[model samples]
Target chain A: MNDVIITAIQQTLIEGNVETAETAARAALEAGVDAQTILNEGLMRGADIVGQQFEAGEVFLPQLMFTARALKAAMAIITPELKRLSAESGISSSKGRVVLATIQSDIHDIGKNIVSTMLTTGGFEVIDLGVDVPIKRIISTALDEGADIIGCSAMLTTSMPFMSDLIKTLEAMGQRERFKVMIGGASVTPAYAERIGADGTAANAVQALQLARQFMQNALA
Target chain B: MDYLEIIDRSDSGEYISEENWDLEKVAMTCMRLVSQYDLKWDRQNLVPDDPALADRVFAAGLALAVEIGAYNRSSERILRFERDELESALRDMKQTLSMGQGADERVLFARQIEDSRPPLVWAGNPGAPHPEALFLPAVVSWAQEPIVDLITCGTLAEVDGREVRTGEALEITATRRELTYLHQALAHVGRPGMGMLAAQSSVSELGDLAAANPDYLRTCDAHLVPMLNELKIDNRNIARAVNSIEYGMRNGGLYCAISGGLGGDAPGCALISVASMILGLLTNRADYHILHPIHIRHVATSTREVLWVESVVLQAFARNAPAIIVTDVYPKSGALTRELLYETAANALAITVSGGHLEGCGSADGLVPHATGLEPRLMGEVGHAACRQGVTRAQANQWILQLMEKYEHVFRMPEGNPGARFDQAYDLETLQPLPEWTRMYEEVKTELKEMGLDLSG
Candidate 1:
């Protein structure tokens, strides 16, 4: 209920711990705090601080892991509470939905996970499909979830063909225009993304969030 | 203070004095790497003359140099290949070929065959020669299986002894040299430049390698070894090395490159390979190009642990640098077979494409007295074709899985004639393909193309 949640979240993000952060979140929820309040005020605020630390190099990968764990734990407790609050308030108009998955044939899930966390912090509904996903399942999931944006992750040069093939599959299924596509990973160059024909490609997590928001806005316009 | 800080003291914690230009911090770090890895530090023992285990060990390491070097270099984009689908695909591919099962090498064009299409060289310790002029022939010649790119230009030799990097002086020289070389090299090769990489080297040595009179090159590459070692690894040395790369780029400017060289070894150190690459990246010359030369590991099955250590270091490096990654492409064992060669190339390709841009060295056997007569050109041919794959790292890696299927069992030894002078592959001087071997090369090429590799282009 106190800054302990905030400090713990901060510590957890960098250290990549999911367990202890989960404990902290459960405790925060038991403290009678509103779910939305913990999410925006406690969880997200903690992630933002950790993001800056990473930016400043005050902390590195180990610290970021802990931070992610803390955030995930806090988000777990707040999801139900937020739903309940929305129902109680009879509110509407939340952020759009995003389907995030690491493409099939590639098991590199770290980049996708980081991007998913960033998208969640942006308040978008992120549905992460994990790594090494087949093209068919991704297309099916996007259609079923009614996702507005589809983010495909590939970290291998060998696996890049999957990205192109996934797009081709979406096009074949007549669902290509239904969702915006985003591609990313370390070996992914802008030239490659353009060559492969993804609607958008981000270099890193921060860039992913910016592009995602922009894509949705453009669609609306 | 850290190591850099400690090195800074040599320069009085200021700039490198004019007297101490061209030293390298990477070379300094080489000492520690050798001690840690417990590897021998000489290339001469490439062929042991005695029964000494140390001599044999050096020969083993040299053999590995061919394995790693000629094996289809790559080590960037590792994340893409780190998937279950890719891993499973390789597992399945290895199972298909009865010979697959070894820690030494394999070819990989992708994480999965489903993802493995062609026109992409995922891993080929490719040549990125400076001077864009080499493009037409470079590309044409490179159209073969393993050769991948032609880095048009990079850093030059020297500028006011400060090892000129990132300035107008470097640019002027690079552009001029590139124009001169491109016009001539292309004229002979007959192709326009398609893909170019950054040039790297000392501009001061422009007049030197231009003196590529075999005698001069031999001197620069070998004789000047002692002086290069004297500069000890430090920031100034790093700067000098960076500047020299800048000079190499200048000589072959506008070709696109990430700078580094082969001399990053401590005068006599076993870890020269890693040191050379680390020095190249630390210079903040990411914009121009990228350079990474994976440390060599011995081919001896007894030394598998040593090889892994080098691989892990390269894995870390793959995440750190942005430029294309180049690693060894051969397996290093004298017992290598054509099938095993393909498999090792495939495995090395898998690691390279996933990890980074690979250089397919065709590091086919050479240097040994009997290891001769094994065609180095075929090695180059495989390199050129494999490099053009452009497939995903995981898919490219799958090719290694395919190769391991046929070659892993032979990592230690395979087959040989009763009167064989050497164990398996031959040395450089004797590198010639018997008609049967030539036919085998043709057969492999056709088969790879059938797999959708599209090497004919």
Candidate 2:
């Protein structure tokens, strides 16, 4: 019965039916299926398939976005249960925490938001700082939240220099070692990331998740 | 109505989230319409040879425009248009624009596919960031190129050692400085009355407004007002559009639609691009449209998918509307290399055969200060050569696919090369390509000739 409910949740997410996915989440929880199992075996499993399909070009961005939205809805239903379970068991459950933002002087943020959605669905906690964010604010928030990684995006060639400025500021503050900095956008290159002293860089959301995961693994080790 | 009325309408439209408008409405609408029209991209043919396919794509784009409309980020609204309004805008749009005066005078008009008239070259280091000190030399490099018909120089990376701020005094000063440098460059080349595109340094309306007068930017000159990607526009853009009209300047709307963005793939990007050109005409009262379908994965327009997108979008405009169309060739490779030449040649060929007047030489994808005269000179040269070859759309598509294979590997480079800087690629005093860069250019021309592309003018 629990397996049936979990599969229903997973299939609903894959279908990108947000309402049905939400309902399936509640049904699974009511059926006494554990929160982690639902998230791992159901939503994340569905998300993994969606990500693969997207990578393969079988599904375009809109379908990916719809699937992401459905997964977000399912997560909303299961998150409180996750917190309660963690509190009862005296353990925290999350891959890592990420802070994402589109750097200053550029208002383009669709790519940043997509990365945020991907990171969130991939089980990492994400704090999106939105667009036109200054360098100081990004560092302060990352420090305050004890974020595991900082992802910066800038779409305009005019605004690409801010990523370099961010690294310089982080180094000057002597707190550069505390966080992993990743830079990307349409104009950003992997060499730019290295020149700007970022820990890593990614071209898209899927690669970003891989970078974040690698950073987290290195941090934990 | 006029610009202010359009602004008011933009402000009064239905409120929606930026995500829903860009991701849901634009994406889903374009995708479903693609399916409804039975529009399937032929991976083998980058440029569609069939007239019916081009019409179907345009029809789907028009349908999507009517259904989804454009979003206004500042007002949090959807700037919906009526069929009659769009029709009237199309019917009344000035089909031809005479830019500049005297010996440098040129006419920009709506073009059909395989239009025999030579594609006008609007050459410059568009959007490439440059040191304030190197600005004049760089501007002169582009202006002095005899093949270049129009000019729009690169933006000054700094003014008095500080980054340019939007709506600030720096914007005004920098814009004036940009025009001064452009004027100086033109006079240096003795093409003093050359038609130029201006105000690229402007971060807001202040620069355009401050520079819109005849002294800085002339009535014959054009000013750029870009529609933010995924069909979003702001008050600053609106103000610039209106300001240009008031000053009798041509309002040029720049739209760079991205794949994996609002548009899903080549087909989706083409559809969204068509809708964007129409909306740009109605909303900005634009005299010409610069349509660039950029691929997000490589940040370069020389790839197979981007070339396909560019061809189809330009063909759609060519076949349907009698509107002035200008497209850009953003080479992923930096200047002074054989790779840059090959990429520029392929991109230039695609723009020429698919019916777009080329407007670029964005070396290193406009990231580095590495742009030089030779690549743009090559763009015009190769474009004119392609035009003379009587290249068919199918032939251009096949050649483009083969050509992309030569330089697409560069996209895999980790730090996209800022390429060789201006000083490295050109002689500053003479504004000519250095010997090594000249050698590379000659060698690539031969290589292109060997590949069956006619380079002889």
Candidate 3:
């Protein structure tokens, strides 16, 4: 019966049916399925399928966004239950926390938003600072939230210098060793990433996920 | 509708959060219209020769424009428009406009599908980044091309060896220096009266406002007022339009609809492109339009899907409401490579035959400073040759397919076709193509001729 409810939740998420996804999560919870099992076996599975479809070019941004929305809906219901379980057992359940922003003076956020959605669905806790975000605010927020990584996006060449400034500021504050910094966007090249001392850069959202995961692994190591 | 009314509506119109506006209003509405209009993108037919399909796309686009309108990012409101207002704006648009002064002056006109007249060649490495040292010679390269009727240029990556940061004092300096170099380059090339689409140094309204002097961006030259992704606009571009309109300079509404973004696939992107153009007619008060549909993944306009989107959008406007449309020829590959020439040729053939004047060689996808004058020269040659041969949509499609086969592999590569930088491709002193680059151009020209383009003329 629990397996049936979990499959329903997964199917609803894959179909991007927000209301049904929420209702399915409620049903799973009422049926006594643990929050972690529902998340890992159902929501994450659906998101993984959607992400794969997006990477394969079988689906596009809208589908990815809709699926992410469905995941958000389901996560909203399951988060408190998972928090309760975490408090009881003293175990944290998250891949890693990522703070994302489009650098200052760059109002382009489509790429950043896409990355945020992918990170959320890929099991990372994402705090999106939105576009035209100042480096100071991004650093303060990441420090406040204890984020594991900072992903900065800049589509304009003028805004790219701020990424360097972000690293410099972190180093000045003696916090460069605390978080992994990744940079990307239309104008950001791998060479620019190396020049600015970014931990890594990715060409697209799929690769961005891989890069972020690698950063987390290296952090653990 | 008054321009002030557009601004007032932006403040007072129906409110929707930006997220809801993007997904529900823009994306869902586009998907509904795509189905309602029975529009389907045929991958095999990148340049569809169907007039009825074009008309359907225009109707769907007009409906979309009325439904969603333009979202104001500042106010988070929809700048709603009545169908009559949009129609009136399109009807009253300038059918012909003259650019430049004296012997260099040229008249831009609305082009019909397969129009016999040779399309005006507006050449440049538009929006690409260039070091300060290369800026002057790069502009001169495009200006000196005898086949180029007008010119455009890239932005300066630096000023006096210092990096340019937006919203700073250096923005003003960079913008002014850009125009000064442009002016000097045109005069140095003996085409002092040549018109330009410039002010690329303007990352915001600050640089544009600073460059409004006659010595900088003249009334004769034009500047871009870009619409954000999908159907969104902000105060920065609004300020640019207001400044240019009051200052008497021309405004080119730049709509770069992402192929796989809000609008899905080629047909949906065409729909969004048409709607954006209609809104731009009122919002930007544009004298002309630049169709620059880029792939969401590749970010280049020369892809097969983007070419199809460009063809359909241009055809829709040409058939329904004729306007002066210039297609940006941003290819994936850069200079010193046959792939760049092939991409340029395919883009030129597709756009020129589909009622779009040429403006590009934003090579290497406009990311690197990997562009030079030779690619724009090839763009003009291919565009004029296609017109001279009177190639039909079918013939252009066939040639484009052959050309795509030669370069499409690069898009799949991880390194992404970063061919060669400007300094490596051209001689700094003479501002001429290097030997190897010229050889690649000649070889590509020969191959294109064998494919039935009349290059001899």
The positional error of residue A220 in candidate 3, measured at the CA in angstroms, is 3.1
Instruction: Point out the higher-scoring one by DockQ: 2 or 3.
Output: 3
Q: Candidate 1's residue-wise lDDT over B245-349, tens digit each?
A: 333321110111111111222222223333323222221222221222222112221122222322333343333322233333434332233653454345344
Evaluate residue B355 in candidate 1 and report its C-alpha lDDT on the 0 to 100 scale: 40
- The candidate scoring highest on lDDT is 3
Give the TM-score (0 to 1) of chain B in model 3.
0.99
Q: Candidate 3 — which residues are off by over 4 angstroms? A: none
Error of 2 at B331 (Å): 1.6
Candidate 2: segments with Cα more than 4 A from true spot: A1-8, A55-58, A97-99, A134-150, A157-182, A186-203, A214-221, B165-169, B416-418
Which should have the higher TM-score, number 1 or number 3?
3
Report lDDT (Cα) of residue B408, candidate 1.
51
Ranking by lDDT: 3, 2, 1
Which candidate number maximizes DockQ?
3
Give the DockQ ranking, best first: 3, 2, 1
* Model-by-model DockQ, in order: 0.01, 0.42, 0.79
Scored against the true structure, residue B201 in model 2 reaches a CA lDDT of 83
Q: Against the unseen true structure, what C-alpha lDDT does each candidate score?
A: 0.42, 0.82, 0.90
For candidate 3, write residues B224-304 as lDDT tens digits.
998898899987788889999999999999999988888887778889999999999888878999999989888888888
Structure candidate 3, residue pairs in collision: none
